[model samples]
Target: MQKLVSEMDNMVLRGEIPQAVAKFFSNSAHTKDVDGSETATKEEAIQKLTGFVGAIAKVNEISLLNSSVGQDVSMSEFRFHFQMEDGSEINWHEVIRRKWKDGQVIDETYFQN
Candidate 1:
């Protein structure tokens, strides 16, 4: 989980969306659910993330407020902020749920507030 967040932060800093999305999901179902749709597979998740990233300008920061881990799932509360071309800031509260498989995230769900 820490590694995923760190990699995401690095991609944001570099303005690399594709790389960020690649690290965003473990499968398509995870990505589909994140988009407020039905479950998807890894490929579907990748396609969805691709579209989402294309719409956003640049991410300024991702702040994690807290995290809790269960037997197979981990939940994290975070604030995601982005910078627009006009120097405006947009903030969103997010809850990230990750499913662990062999100590790595094999699936993820992102909830926006």
Candidate 2:
């Protein structure tokens, strides 16, 4: 699970969020954002991630600050800096917690710092 979480985080850092979602999320996966918005399935999650990535004009940096993995759960802390298409900047820290089942993420929640 640790390796899996690391790989997924790497993929996201590289702006391969859609691919990461496809590879790591279960078909019935659910995702909740820090804002309390939710995605009920893997397809929705992929679309949401893709849209967010698309809005980024450039990725300044994406750093994995910390991480931990337990039996079926993983948490990763990340810092993101990005330039948006509208010339706005987004710099924030967030922690992603995922619940895994059958080697795929069934639930994911994002907490903003």
Candidate 3:
């Protein structure tokens, strides 16, 4: 379960949406990008993330900082660094909380710094 979050982050950062949808999320998965955002369905989640990938110039790294697992849930903190089209860089420090069911994530939320 703990590794799932890391795998999903890599997939998103690398624009591997098909694999991410197939391996990381369940059919009814719900994902919230940040606070106050509506939880999205599997397809919506994929589209949202794919859009993000297209908007970025390059992904420098997705560094996992910490992780913990407890009873069907996994939490991970990661720093995502990427460059914009204009050559500006941004680093996002965020925590992902995921609920797993039958080896797939059914719910996920990202809290950012």
Candidate 4:
């Protein structure tokens, strides 16, 4: 599980978010905000991730703050620091819980505050 997460982290750092997202998410995967305000199906998630990856100028760093793996779900807390076209730095912090099945993520909830 840690190895998979590391691969995704590296993919993001290399600006390969679409590939990363696709590699771990199932065809019917669903991702939603923790508050249930926003949700993305597998297709939507791919589209959104493409846009996000295309918009990134450079990935400055990825920090794995913590993580825990349960029977069928895993919670990961992490931070992404990146640069925009104008050379501005941004830090995004979030905790994401993912339910896994058949070695792929079937459901994910993102927590941001």
Candidate 5:
């Protein structure tokens, strides 16, 4: 599980979010965002991730700050520094909790700091 999460994080850091979602998320996967918005399916999750990645002008930095794996659950903390296409800069820390099944993420939730 640790290796799986590490691979997914590396993909995201490399701006391969859509590919990561396609590879790591289960067909019935769902996700919840910090704003309380939720996605009900893997397709929705993919679209959401693609849209987010599309808005990034450049990735200044992205790094994994911490991570832990336990049974069927894993948590990863990430720091993101980026500039948006609209000229806005974003630098924030976020934690993602994932519930896994059959080596794929079935559920994910994000908490931003």
Candidate 6:
């Protein structure tokens, strides 16, 4: 579990958005809003996140804020720092829940804050 998290950290630090999306994500991603509407699909999720993160030139750091592991679900919070083109910095926070199937992530829910 630590190894997987480390890999994710590395992916983000390297600004390898595609590899990060593929390695840590599943084909089915979903988010339910406060009104209970859901947006699903890993592709869409990746597109949205990549568009947001890709605007930056480089990622400076990824920090694990917290984690909780259940029988088949793992929940984590990560803090991401990025370096922009003009030498500005931005920080983003994400909460992710991964549902494992056969030892791999089969479904995921990611929230950006």
Q: How many backbone clashes does candidate 4 have?
A: 0
TM-score of 1: 0.61
Please provide, for model 4 over 1-113, each residue's C-alpha lDDT reduced to its tens digit, 9 standing for 90 to 100. 76666676567556676787789988888888655754456777888768766677987777677878887788878788878777677687988888888778888888875
Cα lDDT tens digits for candidate 5, 1-113: 88998999889878787899999999999899988999988999999889999999999989889989999999989999999999999898999999999999999999898
Query: Which stretches in model 4 have alpha-carbon errors above 4 Å?
Result: 1-15, 34-40, 86-89
Cα lDDT tens digits for candidate 6, 7-64: 7656755667556766666677564532354557767767766766667787678777
Error of 6 at 83 (Å): 4.5
CA displacement after TM-score superposition, residue 12 of candidate 2 (Å) = 1.5
Off by over 4 Å in 6: 1-6, 31-39, 83-89, 111-113
Model 5 bad stretches (over 4 Å): none
Every candidate's lDDT: 0.64, 0.93, 0.77, 0.76, 0.92, 0.68
TM-score of each: 0.61, 0.96, 0.79, 0.77, 0.95, 0.60
Best by TM-score: 2
| Tens digits of per-residue lDDT for model 2, 1-113 | 77899899999778798999999999999999988899999999999988999999999999889999999999999999999999999998999999999899999999997
Instruction: Name the runs in model 2 displaced over 4 angstroms.
Output: none
Clashing pairs in 1: 27-41, 27-42, 28-40, 28-41, 28-42, 29-40, 29-41
Task: Sort every candidate by TM-score, greatest first.
Answer: 2, 5, 3, 4, 1, 6
Question: Against the correct fold, how does model 6 do in TM-score?
Answer: 0.60
**Native-referenced Cα lDDT, model 3:** 0.77
Give one digit per residue, the lDDT tens place, for model 1 in 1-113. Answer: 55655565456446564565565545433442545684456666566656755666778776667777787677777777877556667687878777766645567777888
Ranking of predictions according to lDDT: 2, 5, 3, 4, 6, 1
Model 5 lDDT, residue 91, Cα: 95
Question: How many residue pairs clash in all the candidates, one count each?
Answer: 7, 0, 0, 0, 0, 0
lDDT of 5 at 83: 98
